[model samples]
Target: MAVSFVQRRFMSNALQKWAYNLSGFNKLGLMRDDCLYENDDVKEALRRLPQTVVDERNYRLIRAVQLSIQKDILPKEQWTKLEEDVMYLQPFLKEVKKEREEREAWNKQY
Candidate 1:
């Protein structure tokens, strides 16, 4: 079954938070003093991270974020910010899907 955009949005937010927490050790090595969750830039960067890094915990966080967005849990401006990040990724995802289909068709011939 196809997943809706809302589902994807939720997944993305959760994945981002999970990845952020998991990177704590890595952050230590980098010697950054800023807290991951408190920093807007850090959070934004995580939100933009690729799907390959997303894990279960983060997936859940994203779902929560999506639910919050849908229910107006956060302020309207904050929700808009989240939407902006998701919008940025739409084109890239489309390209990836197109390539996957091409690859699948080529394999079918053999």
Candidate 2:
């Protein structure tokens, strides 16, 4: 059972990595998280981020845009690797989502 679980986990991660590479943004040095659309939750997450994180996010975006306009990708070494990519904004977004859910629950007085 443990062996099958390990294989399943490995296969799942392999498929995810393959899909991420096929998505093309990694070529531009953008992580999968960086490609997420800036909806209200994402904007809230950005607002909650530290100045350094915000700066880094902006720099990555600008760099990606510049690369896109130049019809170029980052060097192979600089490409975003699946294992190294972290969803920096996801925690804040999840917090915002939780707050919204709580507010909705409180509002349901009927």
My TM-score estimates for the predictions, one after another, are 0.31, 0.86
Error of 1 at 92 (Å): 1.8
Which candidate has the top score in TM-score?
2
Off by over 4 Å in 2: 1-3
> Taking the tens digit of each residue's C-alpha lDDT, what string does model 1 give over 1-110?
99999999989998976665455422222112222353444444445556654353364356555765676343333332322223333444456557667988999997
Candidate 2 local Cα displacement, residue 28, angstroms: 1.0
All candidates' lDDT scores?
Answer: 0.47, 0.87
On residues 1-110, what C-alpha lDDT tens digit does candidate 2 reach at each position? 25698899999999998998898888887776688888988888889999998898789999999988899899989989988888888898899999988988999965
RMSD of each: 16.0, 2.4
In candidate 1, position 54 carries an lDDT of 39
